[model samples]
Target: MNPSASQNIRPETVAKVRTGIPGFDSISEGGLPRARATLIAGTAGSAKTVFAVHYLAAGITQADEPGVFVTFEDSVADVRKNMLGFGWDIARWEKEGKWAFVDAAPDAEGPIAIVGDYDLGGLLARIEHAVKKIGAKRVSLDSLNALFVQFKDHAMLRAELFRITSTLKRMGVTVVFTGERIDEYGDVTRHGIEEFVADNVVILRNSLEEERRRRTVEILKMRGTTHQRGEFPFTLSSREGIIVIPLSQIQLTQSSSTVRITSGVKELDRMCGGGFFRDSVILASGASGTGKTLLVTQFMSGGFKAKERSLLFAFEESKDQLFRNAAAWGMDFAGMEQKERLMVVNRYPHAMAMEDHLVEMQQIIDDFKPNRVAVDSLSALERVSSLRGFREFVISLTSTLKQKETAGLFTSTSPSLLGGTSVTEKHISTLTDSIILLRYVESFGTMRRALVVLKMRGSQHDDAIREYTIDGKGMHIGDRLSAITGVLSGHTTFEGE
Candidate 1:
């Protein structure tokens, strides 16, 4: 047999170890550098310990890789019990020889001191024994600050820290060392040496903003690899260990569909040049009580009638309210839901952070895999997020929906009751593929609803402002209001008057 030339080719890539934390791998461009030491630093209650533990647990459960946790602050029993609270059965894993704990905490009654002549050889030996016993591929040294506190001399502390990190790297095990930040605003550790000695540095922060505590994670440095910059919001829960939401890292190059889908309303579809393109984003902006929610319901109901799956994410309206409102217009939302063709999810915007809301939405979309998705109002989401954050959210969300090839409709409340542009409208106009405007027009002394297709990319749309009515049969689009002049400016005068 002749030797193949492909057998000797070497990959020109740096090896990485998956942390298994949600969004963490994506932000890190893969994961932490393999067989390298990473320093996780943060202040009290910043979840440094939990993050390290989750990494070890994930390695064992998801990668089929054994791990060893060397704790200097918590005992083995304490660590196991605490992990159990997060539904991680570390004790069971230990029994199965898939995980092991090396307790390095000082005895409560014993005087603890690292004499100037002493080295970390004893600790190193213990770690080596545990790793060899379990054939561990991952390790975590919790609270390296605890060891620093025992040492009096700075030189000795730095030497010991460097020695520990170097030895762990030589052991060929991916390692994480937790350290307490000196202050809230700085990434330096208590001894200010851990950051310089480790191959990777991740800082977790829990700070007070607007009288509320927000948790964030940042990759301060990752040697030999590129990583996502800026701070990303993260959440910790009992069931889900750590979830990092990287808003800036969301890719915008989602695949778009050229196929057009119906708008459900025949006249409206005609105005939009047949229908909207599949995987396109449509922004329906209007004033309060201008039937924005009704339009969304119609869009969703249209999907249901076509036997296409739909998901409605209602922020301001309750599920019952949505059902009743749809029923008033002769649409059976509850029936559609019963048939599993529709999914209505109601959320209180103020109850959670904007990042958390986005994460939840992504999870639901992934699980339901709906053909059509609607967010009743983006104004509520805008209110929950800062201006910059809202813009980022909309871009990230619309891009994701397009990537999934799902048609998306987002409703926004205009500040003006009459025809006028809003800041939000201006910001999102460029991000969306189409824009539909609904306004209130006053003719003589009567108030009426008017609709217009302001912009539809790559398609011809009706330019005239048509009067619409929401009655028992839902929105009825009449002929263009040609007899009325200045309708867009709130006051409309009859053409011949």
Candidate 2:
């Protein structure tokens, strides 16, 4: 209870062990406290096992430090098979004396039975033996809730876990203990016994929001250390294990350039003070059929014509549709691909979670090293996630694009065909460096299209709502709608009506 006692328990200069989990070490400051036990608690199907396996696998593969995995819930074979998807070859690791398993599952070989106020001396001894045999610097005891379930006395279970953790720490082995939670938002653990033994506590949550499931990890507390607060979104990848998206930890030190890149449309470029910034995110928002895609096509072509690499992620159209549409607009998407000047990736919005989509797309951006990137119709992805999730996705995406120091153009479809604000605009307006609005205007008895440079950060832009026309060639920016008012609100009035 005293500050001096707390300081004595965990010294001010406590060292940390990098967990090797992607993006986790950033949020955890420098990773888990060395030679201390960390509690990973989560509800059913929260990938708790995967997290534990990943922690050890990272140490084994990246640091070449051996690890001991002690399982209490899942069998050793299941753990091995389930982890192969993440490219962790547990069997091979075991053969090379790099990994050891202390299988303590019920009815398994050397199961520890709980009769009355049972001591974990036998299990601890087995764990110590495994650690000694493999020379494991990292150890994981998965799902301690299994032991808690059998032990009715909570106080006794807590005492035993503390003792076990203490013994492991004394061995100078950094440890991880996975526990179970009944509810995603309930106590840290099912039995709430690990709070005393764990030097750090991390919670994994898979919560359902608006018919979509979102997974996030939060480091509740880390003794004698600072960590990023709040839950950070993470996704399970087949190649990599659990990847924590350290959104807050991303540095916004992207270098700004005075140079500008073409917006593909000469008039639009002139309107935008000689084109968009070299490292900026632009949003093209409009109702469907407002030529947002056409604008995007022109933007890409402008870059490709200059021999700059371009990447496009089409969410609302297929490869054929996009290529065909480009052909219709007199753009050669297929030829660009063949020439290796442009890369077009078409993905259905419902294919994966927003987090996965962001991570995968970011990876492609990094790999392709494009000079500019575009996402056609982000509104299509909006229906698949909650507003908050979509906002996070946009923030992360814009930050990534900026960090890449490449120009990014994103399209969003408004729900109203005539005129209206979109959900996407509400969430991503401030995040984007520029906003281009396309609207349909009804003058007299005919429908015409209009364009507006709504907001352009760090540059002077045309504030006039200009009427535009689209034909087989492409969008042609015409004169400003001098006689129209309130074009953005979808309700246009004659100047002197």
Query: Best-fitting candidate, measured by lDDT?
Result: 2
TM-score, prediction 1: 0.91
For model 2, what is the C-alpha lDDT against the true structure?
0.88
Q: Which runs of model 2 end up more than 4 angstroms from their true locations?
A: 1-12, 108-118, 150-156, 251-255
Clashing pairs in 2: none
lDDT over C-alpha atoms for residue 153 of model 1: 67
> lDDT score, residue 149, model 2?
70
lDDT of 2 by residue, 447-466 (tens): 99999998878778889889
Give candidate 1 misplaced runs (Cα > 4 Å): 1-13, 110-116, 209-212, 237-239, 485-497
lDDT of 1 by residue, 356-445 (tens): 677678888999999999998898887777676677678878877987999999999889887777667878888888889898988767
